[model samples]
Structures are given as structure tokens and as C-alpha cells.
Target: MSRLTDLIAQAKERDLELGRELEREFKVLSARRSFGLNFERHRPENVELPGRPLRKGDKVRVLPPRGSTTKGDQRLWKVLRIESENGMRLARLELIGVADPESASVAVDDLVVVAEFRDYIYPGLVSTGKVERGGDKPFHTVINGENFYALEALTYTHRGRIDAIYIDPPYNSGASDWKYNNNYVGEDDLYRHSKWLAFMERRLLVARQLLKPSGALIVTIDEHEVRRLGLLLEQTLEGFTIQQVTIVINPKGVTQGYLSRVEEYAFFCFGPECKIYPGDDDLLTSKDSTTSDDGYSRPRWKGLLRSGDEAERKDREQMFYPIWINPKTKRILKAGKYLPLGEEPDFNVKDEEGNVAVWPVRKDLTLGRWGIGVYTFNDLVKKGYVSLGAYDKKRKSWGLSYLSEQLRKEIDEGTLVVLGRDPNTGVADVVYEGAATRKVRTVWHRTSHDAGAYGTDLVGKLLGNGRAFPFPKSLYAVEDALRIIIRGKPDAVVLDFFSGSGTTAHAVMRLNRQDGGRRQSICVTNNEVRSSEQYALKAENLRPGDEEWERHGICEYITKPRIAAAITGRTPDDQVIDGDYKFTDTFPIADGFEENAEFFTLTYETPVSVSHNRAFARIAPLLWMRAGSKGRRIETLPDEGWEVVDTYGLLVNLDKSAAFCQAVGSNGTIGIVYIVTDDDRRFQSVVRHLPDAVEPVRLYESYLNNFRFSMGR
Candidate 1:
């Protein structure tokens, strides 16, 4: 009937066994469904790494002369050496990846570092600045570099340790929002969708390695590519359950031809061990119904009797029970034993003090089962969990309800307000204020999630400019999404590769302030100037690494300044922000968060340049991060044999193993010790003297091995 069937039939005419094998193969291929999203995997992307000064042995690209109409050479070049002539620096360069390489002498300032995605690069981190509010808490880090490279580097230090990752990637909305292979994939490009998929696939594969077994990945996107993204995530992240939630980011919709788009999607991908935690905000209901006088929400109760199929007494024998209540006062007294099959409870039975027995009976007169068994019901009733409501005439019994375990948790956490006991039910009447905790619904609609009011406006207040960044996510929305996964884990390590304006890190700090958590955030963003600004800068003869060009880039102008202002409670010019945070906690902007953060620019390093004393400063932060990011960091190889901080220790001089061992043993707070030595036997010998609680790490080898294997394409 079909082409495949006909081909199999023709093969069968020649050889029966061959045809059978062909049929089996064809069936397996058919099971691989495409669902319309299919494309060829393109070549790896290339990005220009700016800001770092040009030096010998670095791969670079030459920029054209000022006001020149012709384009500069596009071929990759390696710097041979730098020579100063007539008070001007000249770089000797040679073309790379070609048979007959050409060499030329050019101005050192004319070159910028350029890297291909498939190239292996030994990465380094260079600290730019740091801000400390107070305390010895772990520092939140923002790395100014391409996210793909940063993610690859994180695999070495934080593989399988991150608790949650929330990324707001580009929507691929046929604009200059994103780039592929050093060029923006505009609307006119027919292969834009394929390029977007290719870019995401590479980063997601590496990101998957960073999450713990129970970690979660939350990605936000608009309607432009929601369908394709969903399919890509499913195909790439196998074995992980994926669910999407619709959030009304902009109540006033942006018109797209016939439809006014008002909502975006968040796809949460997590393993089976992960669950959507309950929160106090029930977005499905109106704000007035959920919030109370105390800013919390009222407690919700459900019927204690089971409903629907398999709810009859015969279906669950142990759940068939009766609750005794005071007929006049309507107060629940206690629960009775579960009746056996075909056994009917005496509805007329009365206990001492005129307490009447109430059986779980359906309106159709069929015997129904209680949601909980006898022992559990009795325990809950004593804790004021059970309640009696108005009599149901059809069932000939009073309506009964009880708080589930989740609601009880909310009460214990003080998110729900217990106003007073009902005179009739004799059970606590609870109401949820604004900040109650409950399981989130599929659709989310709230004032706090509004982008224009909360997201864009809040950034304006903090940064002193309303248009500092385009289309940032609402602070509350990002915070709530993170809370669902990381509320229970106070020290969660969160990573956001597509960190536009450092909102993810700001959200993490807010969460820490609310619960005194020491959670840390790692944000990666580039310092690319906006397209409109880039054209203007080019007209002025400035290049990517120029001071004027770099200052206006996203990372320098927006992400970095926004994060610092949030931590210090002062703008870049040291002026106090003039506003108060509404809803949720409601605190003044002047009252800064109690948090610490450091800024670093990603550096591409060669293997030969990473020798012990040469690269210690660049590698110190990685060790600090791996050792829980707390305590004083050793920035260089100490003159002494070893250096011991609060949380980690380092021994650069292996010859003084005796002294290093004494220092490490004396420090009770040390958890990880880095021993710099090439000999494995000598390293292990000194490790024996250290306390068993201290984990010994072999230096240079331990760090280099991570990149040696990971750097290959």
C-alpha cells in the first residue's frame, strides 16, 4: 500500500529472509517520529572574545583601519611576538589553519581574540572587582564571557553539584536578539531555526552535566519558538520529565499581526526525584480571595471522604470508618473503627454526652470511604485539622473536611494564618495571606509577574535608567520559579548562562535574605554592545576592546552595575535608591541585601602558560568555588610551604610536607586541601598525615586533567 510496504514486498520476491530483515529495520525507523522539526546540524559557532590585551601566542583577528571601506582579513592569526618601534607596539602575526601560512606585522591594538566553538581552550578567570556587604557567606559570581565556554569550564569545578539552573535564553524571534557563528540570525535567513536549535543543543548538553541528580532546569521563552524548544528539550534531555507553565508577563499584549501576544512559557525539566513544591500564591484565583489582612492567604480544606471511582467502602476496607460528632454543636469528637465488608454502622448510635455517629455516605445512598484511616483521622482531629460544615440534605449527613499534609506544612511554616476556632466545627479557621506556600498551578497570572511594572520599572529604579536592558524577566517571577525548586535547599548552587541583566543572581540574593540561606549564583553574560550602539561606535573608529566601546556593552553597562547596586543599595554614583519593595517581603531599597558578590572576566589560556606560579591567581577562584566559596582565598603561591583558610587549604611547596601537615592538622575548619606536586606517591604520603575529614586534592594535575579531557571538541 505504501512505498515502504511495496519495497519490502519486492525484496520478499527475491529473498524472504532479506525482506524480513528490511521490514524490521523499516519499523524501527518509523518509530522515530519527527513531528515536523527536522534539520541538518550546522558547523560550530564562532565568537569574538574582547577586553583582554593582545599578547604573543594568542589567536586573534585583525580590525580594519578607521574610515576604511574595505573589510579586514577574516582569517585567524596567531601572535608571534610583540615589538616596540618608535614608541608604538607592533605585533608579529602568522595565519593559522592553512597550508602556506602568511605572516605580517600589525599594531598590537588592532587584534581581538576570536574562538570557534569546537576549539579546545584552557580557560582562566580574571577578577575585575568585588563587593561585600557583610558576613563570611559564599560569594555570587558573574563571569563576563560567552556562555558556551563558561559552561564548559564549570564542568571541571561544579560537575553534578548544581542544585538548580534558571535561564531566559533568546526567543529567536527573527530579530537581532541572537547570533550564530559571529553573525546575527535575522528573519530573512531560511536556516535561522536550525541555527537556533544547534546553538541550544551544544549548550544544553554541557549544562546537563552540571546539574545534580535531583536538579532542575527552568527555561523561559516567548511564543516565537515555544513549540520547537519543547521538542528540542525533549529530544536532548532524555529521561527528564518536562512541563510548561504559561505566565502573563505583559498584561497589555504586543500585537503580532492578528493576535496580541500577552503570555510566555517556562519549561521545567527535571528528573523523577524532583517535584513541583507548593507555594502560598495560588495564581489561578483572584488576588483578593487569596490575600488576607496579615498579608498571608487563608488555609484551604478539602472533603475528608474519598470521591470518584474506587471510593466505595468495598474498594478500600480499611478506609471505611465513622466520625463521632456533637449533633447540636456540630463539633467533631473522634473517629471510630473501620467496618468490614457488608458491615453497616449504626447511624443512630450515640456516645456519652449525646455525641452522634456520622458515616461517610454518598448522595446516592452508597457507602463511601473516608480519605484517611481511623488512627490518622483521630490524630488529625486532636490537632484541629478536621472540621464539620453545613448538613448535606442529599447525603443525610454533615459536610466534613480536613487539611491535607501540604496545608499542614504551610501552617507549621507560619505562612497560613489561623484566625480562630469555628464555634460550630471546633476546628481552626485558617486564611492565606499574600505569601502563603502551596503547589503552583499550570497557569500563572499575577501583578508581580507583570514585566513592564515590576521587571522593567524595578530595574529602572535600581539602575537609574528605565531602558538599561530590554525585556528583562520580572524579579518576582524569577524568584518564585527558583523557590519552587530550591526552597528546601538553602545552599543551592544556581547557574544561569543567559543572564541578561543579572536578575537570576539578584533573585537568589533575595531568597537568601528571606530565609538566611547561603545559596550562591553563577551568572554568565557577554559584553557585547547593542546592535544600534555598535554601528555608532564603529562609525567613531572604535573597536570591540576599546575603552569607550567596552563601557557601553551589556555586561559593563547593565549586568555588573545592576548587581552592584542591588548588593550595596546604592547606584553606581553612590546615591541611595529611592523606593520600597512591594508585596512579598516589602522592604526598603536602602536596606541592601546581606550578600557578597565578585565579578570576573573569562580568559582564554594556553596550556604552556598555566604553570604553577604563573597562573595561580587565575585559578584561585575556581578552588575557592569548589571549596564552598566561603573563607579567604589564597591569590598566589605563598612563600611559606602552605596556606590554610577557613574552609580550604593550599600547599605549594611539597618539600615542606611536614610543615604543611602540621598547619592543616591545626586548622579544624579546613575541609579541602590542595597539594601541589607532580609525584603521586609523595602527595598521598602527606595526605595520610592530614585529618580524614579533609579531602586532599592534587594540584596542577587535578586541575589540568579536568581541562585536558574536556577541552577536546
Candidate 2:
């Protein structure tokens, strides 16, 4: 265990029943980051509001309110007033526009206040996923392979508590690859790009609320949408700086090369101090590690090291200066000392004329004599520093490389550089080859590292499906990038929202296994759409059992089952790969969108009630299920997007009550419930929250707003 891990060990191992859930939330809050959140943190910072109270050193979102309007959502002010009634002020207000202003006070309802703190809490092991409402154990579900809209559905369910996220959304393409709410975004549709942007924007907006102050976000993108992605990021994410990484994936060039395509950009937009698990600059990079032919590591420098002054003297006080030395190695002294580097002998001098008797004296010190400082060569060797092993009269250049190698060998053989050194690594470039050279420059390797084949094989096995999704990410490539970011930080939460074939999840697990680190991953995939267009090439007609199996295949069990296998360390039933993961298919609650504690308390509709389908699981409570159960369920995540089922008011968001409304039927039963109200049309369908109807509810309004505005009707 590392020092950081050791410090956090008790916290990680702590049991979270309820208060503990709130407690561990700080850690989660510290961990989770969203894309726009990073940019917001980095961009010109402004004093803003967080959903909660501000603490010192907290990163707050600032909104300048000098020329603000009365028709905007002043949510922070309202929440503060509600908080202030209890005689406490959490938000610090600033009135920048009111011409040398003091706190601008207009309406108690609309005074824009700046809140500084942000934190997210959850109930259990359940990350961002679709949650069910009633009873226990999932009864039935909507099996989506992609589940693209599930997170949107969940925003209402698990509202107000997401910290960080990474998404790889579809770039608009017509090859049956990308989808918008289950519909393909073919190239022919002019609004395809717009639709995709809207879909992403809604998710980003809601994602903002889910982040803590110190959180960040990462989104993956390709060339197709890079142009619009910039604008979309600007509009949706608000205050953040965009960072783009170009990964050279395919060096072989495209099939039809207008230009042999070799690289694709991974555009990254983030907040200040946002970091993925990459190696920090403070740590030495592998490029700095170099070894030489002499089996010794040495610093690589450019230009040349010309010899300094070479005057010799009995009392050589001028030449002695302090030099930095390695202290770690204990010297294996053999009754010897270091030698001084040999210098060029002036052919005219008596020392070179083989006259030990006529050695010249210093002109200034020795009273204007015929030569420079005078001393024998043996006098300089006793200091145990400089080396003069061999000096050729032919070549005046010193063997610098040879000397560096000799020093390295000496250090390796217990020759201390200066004072005896403690084991430490700092203040040097890395030696790449054999740890013998100098600092490595950029542009060394052309082809990037990718494990696409391994990912393809993994996907093929667990789900027992081949070519389920096209062009899934390479497992190794993802790890390579993550390894760059997540250096030395063992326990990290890796998230990938656009999980086409579970490559990100697989890489995290593989890296964890490789390094013996306890890293975890959260991969989200929408139950994608599959066309039933018959294959004209198939020979046989469908059989009786085959028809039923085909019908059953529509369920979203394939992808989730495979990912679960990877997590729990169970062999995927597929034959292509033998590796395992601990996971299960989390079916969404298909029934009961109501708020009825009564069903559990008083009423017994059936032996198994509708509420069983809707109990959203949490992450902390689901550790037991993570022990490789094939069909196990996880615990509920708090304030997540989920539906409440029952008779009373259907709580759309566990946090935002205004997002919900109720309507009662004339027959005294549930007509319908409005879980989604951010949209206008949803109001008509909402059932009144009368105690009689007992209607349950969850909504997709926040998600729908992105698309609703585009409707022609």
C-alpha cells in the first residue's frame, strides 16, 4: 500500500449504512469531475454558486450579475433564503453591476447569491445507472444494449449528486453506427449534428449539477464532430478550457486515402487542476531513463564540455570548489583515491621536457617566475575526486562519455558522489535505452499502443456475440493514455459513458491487475438499436426455438453481462477469451412511476408488489453482490435519476420537487403521473398527486428539452 492509500485505507474500508454514506461522499465528491466543470475551474474564474454551502478553499462557480435579468432562474437565492430563515447565511453575495455596489437586494425570491461549496452523495455501489422503484429484486426490465437515455432518465431519479464523468458519445455518421435516442443519425439528416449536440448539451447541463467543487470532466471525440464540438462545449459547459489530444491510432492509413489518415484528435475540455490518472511532471518520465554500452546510466547533454583551467600548485586553493555527489552508495574503498583529469602539456615547458627538476613556479605568487602554478601530478590525486586515468598527447578532447560511465559504475559499486546519500530520485532526466543516456525528446515512436484485438476478443466471448458493435476502442490504447495520466495513483475510478464494447473498463481492470492496484471502473452503454433486416445470404429458415431465442435477444443482457464478467473475475461464457469480470445486467424498473410508501406500509397488491421493480441500488451496499454473482443486483445511488412509485406525489427528483407535479383521475385511480415537467407537453400527461390515485412516476424532461425545441409541430 502507498502512503496515500494507507491514509485512505480506513475510509475505503469503512462501512456506509447511512451517515457513512454521507461521510464517504466527501471522498466521492473529491473524486468525481465532469467535462465543463474542468473548463469552468480553468477559465477566467468568477464568483458563483454551488448547490451547497461554501467552505474556505472550495472552488466556486461565479456568475457576474451586474446587468442581469429578472426572468432567469435564481435558484441559489431561493435556496439561500430557505437556509437563512434558520438564521444562517451560507452564500456570500457580490453586486458587481450596481456602480460601486453593496449587496444588491431586490427580491427575496430573486437575489442572486454566490455559493462556493459543491459535493455529491450517493446511497451505495450503484454508479450512474437506471434505477427501479418498488419491491425487491428486479422483476422485469427494458433491455437496451446502449441505454443512451438511461442516464438522462436517472438524472431525475438520482438528482443532485454526480461528481465527475467521461463520455464517448457518437459522432454523427450514417453507417448505422451513431444513434440519437435510439434513432440513427444518418448523414442525410441535416439536423443529425444538431440532434447529437442537443443530446450531449442536455447531459452536460445536468452533469454540471452532479460535480463537486474540485471535480473535472473528460469527453472523447473524433474528427467528424470536432468543429461543432468546440462550439457545443462552449455553449453547454460554460466556463472551461478545451484541451485536445491527438492519438495516432492507425499509421497504415485509411482504406481509400485522400490522405492516408494516421491520427485522430481526442478533444479534452476541463476545469483548472483537473487531472486524469496520468503521470505528473514532478515524477521522472520513462523518457528520462537511459543506459549506455558501458552498463552505466549517465546524463545526456548537448554541446560540449571544454576543459577548465589546468594550473597545478602545492597549495592549490583556487581549483577546489564544492561539487554535488550521490550519497546513497557506501564506498568499497580499496586503499585508493580519485585521480584528476590529465591536461595538455605545453611542449615548451620543462614539465613536458621530462624535467622534474625544472618545474616552473607561479609568476604572480612565485615573484614573476617563468611559468604558471607548480605542483607534481601525484599531489592532485589524493583529494579522491578528479580522474586522470589516461591522457593522449594526440587527442586533446577528454573522454566525457567514458568518464560518465566510470562515475556510474563507481556509484553502482558503492562510490558516493558527495556526502553519503539517502535513497532518492530527483534532479535528472530519464535514461531511455539501458538507462545510460539523457532526457528523451518528443516524436520517438510513430505508431501508438492499442489493444483493440484483445478488446474485440473479450467482447466476443462474455456476451458470446461477434461484431456486436463496430470500431470499438482498443483496450491497450486506452490503457496507454490512462497510464500516462494515472501514474502512481493506484485506486482510481475510471468512467466511460460511451462504452461501445467495454474497452475502457477492460483496460482499467487489466492495468489494475498488472500493477496490483485496486482501481475500479464505471462503464455506461445505452441499449443500442439493432435492425431486424434479414440477411439475404443466410441459407436456413428460422426454427421454432430459434424464433423464441431471437425474440429474447432483444433484451439488453449481452453487453452488461460481459462487463459484469470482467469485473467479478468470471470467465465470459464466450469461447474467444478466457478472462473474467464481476458484473451483472442491471435491468431498469419498467413499472411503477409513483410515490407510495403506503404500498410497503399498508397495502399488499400481490405477493410481489410493483415497487420491487423500482428499488434503485447504491454502490456501498452492493459490495457483496460484486463477489462474482452472475445475476446479482447492486444497491441504490442517492439523488440519482430514478422514478418513485406509489399513491402520493411522484417525486421526480429526490432533490428538486418543482420538477414534478401531479394529476388525479376522475375514477379515483391513477390517470398518469408527470415525472418529466421541464418540458411543456409533459404537463398534460401528469397525474395530480392526490392520495387516491397512488400513481408512481419518473421523468425524462431534462433530457427531452434538448430535442423538444426542435420539433416542428
Candidate 3:
């Protein structure tokens, strides 16, 4: 050990960089086993763009011929020229950055254009189309692109503004559902675990910056990666509080060796200001448990008379008060102030309606204190939070009850229904239509959460194809998960990067319908074609970017159509959808939600294009999102000097600053002012003169600097 230390010290003195490397290697060699996460962090993941055609001077990669091998060459080739020979199209290619470069000729169809993760690409969006319900409701956006790049772009527009994020990333259970470095990782793959961690870590780091201070992030996974994912979240989201909940998605269970797996896990990471809200059900009862006679679960009221330790009136003088009740109706009218310790009680006091006074007394006839103080009881009486209990034969007086804080909140949020006045109490007779709410439990078992019956089957019905996509989340499950954190925020902004089949967006729409909320969801997914579909398309000589092949991509094939069907209450074939949404709220599917949605494909642009103001058409939607995504978007440069719309304003000509400011001030609803100019001094001067409420942004320059800083352009 002494000799080893001496050698290490000498190596460090000789060369600091090499010494650190040697020390690291020594630690690995001497350890019993490596711990924590370890992987090739810099290994670039490559994706092929079949939509981009091969052209001379464009970089390309040679793809293996069909039925050859699963492994393909990772080497990148540069296209030198394109030529036709013997009725065949061929391209000359050169290996880039080689000292003695080698050149070869390959058929155009044999190569695919690649986007390497190591290089930075300017990102933009192109609107494909939209579904409008004709209202001022914010549009739920679905972007088709690699999630990492989409998240990077969102950081500029939605940073620190999202209220909640729910994602269902691939489980990496040695299935074909997930990919690493553009290849599916089989069960036998040696580094699959490490690759999964690295892939998740990169995206999560960027996602962490998109949350508001009060926002929460919910990630659902199966047993295959739950433990590893939990550890990764701990390291990545250091200060946030993390909790895990187990949900039974398959009650029958799938057999695995000794035990049958029936449940998955959802990890909830709550920010400092985040909290779990109440659900319709107590979330604790067994699926088969019986409810009340009305098919509802009602709150069990507690007596208002103090009992047990410190129950005497002398214990708390302030709690010793008289509750006036109408003798005829048994209705609680008001609460009288507390009696002094030396004062004698008056049981004969009556209100103008011949109401009698009631004192808190024990069964033994000893004086007791009220459960709540006089002021609290008085306020609760007005809000119907107080209740009257049945007559007690032993005490010869009617008892009183009150609601807990959790139950009161349920009444306020409309989760509990109020059925006029109770004949006995005259207070609002509120009852929960399902199970009474309680603190969210760690274990959840509901028939609606079953993946097969609700998830796979429901999605099949919507898409009209049983296998359009696999393993979509149960609609009710997603809604319940989101409701726990965002129940109070009616106009929240929710995002899901791994938006499979657009489940998160559909769930958000359902939530909005349930409560009349205007919450908007931003879903991002890739347009990668399924492996089986790719093989079939390739057999027909169809490439990825071809119209027919592109239509089969996940976004176009499943997500877009599913969302449209859900919003329009009709299937892609123009027939009304069958069935109804169950659990929490039930309504016919044909009565589609009154909502608006838009689809966009992520596009790449040159920084030069954005800086020269040539890409305003592409960048306009993003600005609308940044300005709260309300009203109509300014899609083109105004022919007039300036333009002011519902939520934002734009000044195309600096000569119209005064008019623009006047219009902005007069409108009073605009919150963002985009001034198009390259001059910093002039922009600052105008900003100071504008209204104090609006935020000023320098166009082109501000847009260029954002990506340049984040993407290192």
C-alpha cells in the first residue's frame, strides 16, 4: 500500500492529467465491484431522416443490404457526387477527415441521411394542420421530433412556466419498444443498463429546467427499470422530494418465475411548493368493496363535543360556547360567544325563530368543551361545513358534527355534490359520489387502471386498429395522476415529452371537461416508424421520407388521428366513436370535448435564416406560446408598422413606436412586446417608455442568442 501511494504521488507530480486517469483505473481494478451508474456518456445516438433526400455534398451513412446482419457500419461518409450508370443512380462518397481519404461509389437507395447527436442543429417548427372547436381555449400542441431537441426548444419558450409534467418513457424491458444508438437492445446486450441510464439522464437534465418553482414531474415505469430510475432521479433532482406509488395495471398478473407481476410504479418528484391534492376516491378501498346505498361514499362526521384527554370546559374556556339550533327544524342557526370561567351557563336562551341553546355536556352530565372554537364554528355554519347529528337518547339532546379540512376542500372544489338542505341540519347535505377522499395512498388498485381493458382496448377502439400502437396508458390512470398535483390550477400548462399515442393530451382534455378548466397540454413525440412497418414499407421500395411511409409514422398514424377523434367525437373514418369515459366522471364519447389542438413537425433551420428575419413564419408559433398561447397568433410580418393582438404585440417598424405603445396601452391585454430591431440602444430606450406590465424582447437578436447559448451555435 505504501509503495502504491508513493508511485501515485510520483505520477501525479510528473503529469497531473495522466495521474488522475491512472488513479481512476486503479480504483476500478481494486474494487470488489463497480457501484452506482457507469456508461459511455459521449456515445452519440444517430437517427436516419428518410424524408431528407440524398444529395451531392450532403453527409450520409451506408446502410447494410436487407437480410445481411443486424449490425451496420457506424462510419460516416460524405457524398461527393451523384451520377447514373446503366439505368441505376449512384453516388460517389468520401470518408471525412481522413489523412489519405478513401472514396467509393454506392447506390443512392442504399444510403440514409443521418442526424448525429454530437452535432448541434438549429430547431424550428412547421405547422401541419389543426382541429378547432371555435373558442378562445388555448390550443394543445403536439410536436413530432426527437424529444431531446424538442425539450431544448421548449426551454426558450416555456422555461419555469409549466405547472406539471407527466411522462411514460419506454421501460427498456429487453423489448423492441425502445432503442439505443438506433438499434434495439436485446436481453443479451451487455451494456443495455448503462445505455438506458445515459439516455434518460441527458433528457431529464434538460427537462428539469422547464418546470416552475411549484411544478411537479411524474414518471411511470415497470419493474424492469424502476429501481435504476429512482436512483437516477435522486441524483438528478437533488433538492426535490421524491415519492413512489404502486399501481396495479394487470390484476391477473403476468407470470415470471416464482411470482406473477401485476403492478407498475410511478415516481413523483415534487418541488418545494408542490402538494398532493384530494381525489374523488379515498384511493384506499379494495376494488370490490361495497359503497353506500346511493352508490356513493359519504364522509363520516365526527361529534363536535370534545372528549377524552382535556375534555372539561375548564381545560379550554374559549371552546366552551353555545350553539343555537332551531327547535322545529333541528337546524343550526349560529354560535354564541364563549362563556367566562366564572360565568354561569344559560341553557334557556332562544333565537327569534324559537331556537334553543345547546351546551357541550358529557353523558355523565359534566360540562365539556366544543370541538371547535366559537369563531370557527360560526364561520363553518355559514359555509355548510358544520353538520347536525341524530338525537342521543341517553343524553336527551341532539348531537352536532363537523367536517375535516380535507372534506371541506372537496366541497369547495365540487368533488362532493351538495343535495339541497338536510331535513335535520338545514346545512348543505354534501356527499361524495364515489369513495370519500383521503390522503393519496402508496398503493392503487382500480378496475379503470387495468391496462388491457382500458388502455389497449380503448386505444384500439379509438384508432380502429387493434395494433396501431402498443402499451398506451389507461386514460383514467393518467387523469388521476395529474389530478393529484394540478387539481387547483385550472389553467395550468402540462407537458409530456414521451407522449405515446397522445395519451397525456387526451387525459388533459378530459380533465378540462370535468372541471371546465382551460389547461393546455404540450405533447412531444418522434415520428419513427415501427420496425415491422419499416420492413413492409421497404419491401415496396418506399423510404422513410416518402409520403406513404411518413404517413405510417407514430405521430401521423396514431397520435394525431387519436387526438382529432377525441376532440371531434368521431373516428378517422367519420363515424361517431362508441363507448364512454368511466371513473371519476362518465359521459358519452360522441359528446366530444370542446377543445382545440394543433399538430407541428419539428424542422431544422440555419442560424443565418433566423438572424436575417427570414424564419419569422416558422418562429411565430413559438412566440405565441411564450406569450401564454392565447388568441390568434401573428404568423407573418405586419404590413403596417405594428400589430397588437389579444395576448401579445409586435413592432415591425421602429418608426411606429409611439403608435405601438399607444395601441398596447389601450388594448391592456398584451403582456409581451416583441420589437424587431438590431440596434440595442434604440430597443432599450423604447422598452423604458412602454407600459411596465409588458415584457420586451429584441427580435431576431434575442431569438438567435437563445439557441446560440443553449445549443452552442
Q: Which stretches of candidate 1 lie over 4 Å from their true place?
A: 1-37, 53-57, 67-72, 78-104, 286-421, 424-436, 465-467, 711-713
Which segments of model 3 are wrong by more than 4 Å?
A: 1-39, 53-58, 63-73, 79-93, 96-100, 104-111, 286-437, 465-467, 710-713
What is the clash count of model 1?
Answer: 19
For all candidates, the clash counts are 19, 131, 2
Give residue 89's lDDT in candidate 3 (0 to 100): 97
Worst 10 contiguous positions by lDDT, candidate 2: 595-604
Residues 411-507, candidate 2, lDDT per residue (tens digit)? Answer: 4544213332223322222222332223221222222233234445545555554435455565555655566444355645444556665566556
The positional error of residue 397 in candidate 1, measured at the CA in angstroms, is 37
lDDT digits (tens) for residues 326-353 of candidate 3: 7677778888889999998876677676
Highest TM-score: which candidate?
A: 1
TM-score of 2: 0.41
- Please estimate how well model 3 matches the true structure, expressed as its whole-model Cα lDDT: 0.82
- For model 2, the local distance difference test gives 0.37
For all the candidates, what are their Cα RMSDs to the real structure? Answer: 13.8, 25.3, 13.0
